[model samples]
Target chain A: MNALGNAFSLLAGGERETWWTIATSLRFSLWSTVFAVIPGVPLGAALFLGRFKGKRVAVAMVNAIMAVPTVVVGLFVYSFISRSGPLGSLNMLYAPAGVIAGQALLAFPLVTAMSYTGLQKLDPRYNETLLTLGARPWRRMIAIIREGRFVIVQAVLAGFGRVTGEVGVSMMLGGNIRWYTRTMTTTIALDAGKGEFERALSLGIVLLGVALSINFLSHLAVRDAR
Target chain B: MHADAVRNDAVRNDAVRNDAVRNAPAFSVSRLTFRYERKVAVSCDSLEIHRGETVAFTGSNGSGKTTMLKLLNGLLGPYDGRIDFLGLPLARNPLLRDRSVFVHQHPVLFSGTVKDNFEYALRLKRVRGAEAAKRIAMTVERFSIGPLLEREAGRLSGGETQRVAVARAVAAGADVILLDEPTSSMDSASGSAIRAFLLELRRSGTTLVFSTHDASLVLDLAGRSVRFESGRVVDEPSTGGTL
Candidate 1:
């Protein structure tokens, strides 16, 4: 109980390091979500709109990837960016870029799977109407994306939540370098490991708040869509 | 005298070709079979629709009338046989979409104002500027839909949505319109409005194909009737239609 009180005071007292850690976590998560969405949404749209053999298998693969452990994703990216690996010369490891890249990779399958599943719920008549009106392939996709924007927004929020709360990617790729690469989750892990419970509990509280806020926004998106 | 005889023969041949073109069927189907997840939905052996003809497909629920309409519009495919539009094979005729449009039963009006829906349809056909404005004006006047123009399409009532959908199609310059149960579940007022609009379309010499359970619609509008039973076309007969 005393540790919880101290955690709240630390948050209320506006400690500089704690706030910076929160900001770094948010910034990295936002950038990762943007990177993931750039390619992920279109891939999801293709998976949903395309008609071909092996499409079912492709969808199944994306779903399976979404369930993969964050540590596994971190390891995969680390292998690529580590020295002597394929992309080692870029020097992304132990840097903010590496953390963002790792988080984006971790969120990519989630965004793709969620977006595809969301688009599946769109009205069949919308596509038929677009087809009958002679919309070309590109125009049809844009229209479909616009029509399902609400569901897509939910998928994006889900991706943001995923990267924001994950510890493994940040710990492995960002290297938990103090004053530079340290994020809320990595800081919490480090502080908790050193028997310092107050800051860790505070960051946990913040993470919970972020999760609830994302869920609320998702609900609002659905309501507006209706 | 010899030259005049040759000229007259040439004119006669040209006239014959023109008549044949004018009389060509809008759609011709042969041995069409469409299946849904292993169960046959439509298996039509032969069907034809003439230019400027209003044809009604009458059938019980799940009897494949809607599927036939979709096939005719080229919305579904991989069927076993062939469909020809205006004497050319359907597969080779990409311009068929420019000349034909399909309307669903509930009529999906895109998420915007009714005027926006009209603009979208016209834009699909590459109609713009003065010509698009002219078409919108003409359609609004003809349908008496001026009041509904600025209203959000999603908020429109059932009858209004159907009216806007058909009017929007007309504005897009569709020569042939296929509709699926346009008035199946409408109230009397809405149903009457749709029937009246359909009558107007027929009188304008547009080729119309529709599926309906309404007997009076068939009696009043159809130039011919096709009946469907268990995914097969049972009969197609001219009923002295179009009163």
Candidate 2:
């Protein structure tokens, strides 16, 4: 009850800060999705279509990645971007870019695994038809992707949902600095820890809204893909 | 890739031939064999099909007719023997598949509208604008699928999807259409419609090689029928041994 009351209070007095946090959250999630899905889709399709050796092992690796903890991802990326690490020369530590990199790694496995199952289940008859019709290699690939778009789209939206609400990656990699990399989830965590219930509850509401929206869209896409 | 064989790149006979017997056979094979996961699916020796011939491969389940059809269309390959398309070996005729389309037992209508499925091949072959439109229109009307053009292909009834699949193959203008049980699961109305469509295709000079367990369809449609059992075409020919 107190959290609900605090949320309304924050809504009245903290509109600008709330909007900024939401914007940062959206930006972080969107960029992470882009980075993850660009490579995830082709890799997923190739894993499904290619019949060479050790494909099962590759697929198993992706499945294993999906089970990894988000905090572990945060730590791995944090270590890489730290001043003493190999990539430290870039000075990305505690920056929004570091947050994006960590979150992208967190999302990659989900997208690949989902898309692989999607393309794997696709009827092989379509490929044969395309070949017999003399579709050029590029055209065939594009057509297959388009036909398989629903699975990829669902994977992307699911990844976006996960990344949007994840506090560990942003808290560790972005340092959750106010007026800079402070995203909805990270701010909510920090505010709650400091007993600032209104700001925390308000941020929680915004993050929940984003997560619900992504879930709704994913539901529609899965149904439509059928 | 044969080391000790003469390459018959000339895909025509040297002598003049009568209209009844074409100079080039549609498919000529010697020792054609295929295996799937340690089980021999097809093992045929010395088989030839002529142009415009309607050949039915009748067999029980798991008898390898479908596998043989796939091999003929270049979908499965690297078999035990040579397959010549119109007197030229597969190695010399890379465009062989462009001339032969295979329709599966349960044709998969991909995710799109029926019109999209019908136009997929034409667009692939780069048939553009008015020509593509005209062909699509002609095919839709000819196949009696005009009402279904706007329906989602993936949402269609099984029989409706099969009709569209057959029409798509026809619209693509493939020389040889290999169908595996095209009418097996269809309702009587749909079955009769497919039967009529196949007859029309035959009249249009499109060669058809289909597998079926339906003896009546073979009796009504095929000029030649070959029985298959245990992965080999039995010597009993329904018509003359050679057409």
Model 2, B1-243: lDDT tens per residue? 231232343233222212213567888878877878877889988788888989999888888888888888887866888887766566536447557788888888767788877677788777777898899999987777888999998788778878888888778777788899989988998899889888888888888999999978888888888888989976455474231
iRMSD in angstroms, per model: 0.7, 1.6
Candidate 1 residues A94-208, lDDT tens each?
A: 9999999999998999999988999999898888898888887777888888889998999899999999999999999999998889999999999999999999999999999
lDDT of 2 by residue, A13-125 (tens): 76898888889889988999899998887778777766688989999999999899888999999889998998999988888889999999999988888888878777687
- Candidate 2, chain A: TM-score against the reference: 0.92
> DockQ of all candidates, in order?
0.62, 0.58
DockQ of 2: 0.58
Error of 2 at B167 (Å): 2.3
What TM-score does chain A of each model score against the native chain A?
Answer: 0.98, 0.92
Instruction: Give residue A73's error in model 1 in angstroms.
Output: 1.4
- Return the lDDT, model 1, position A9: 98
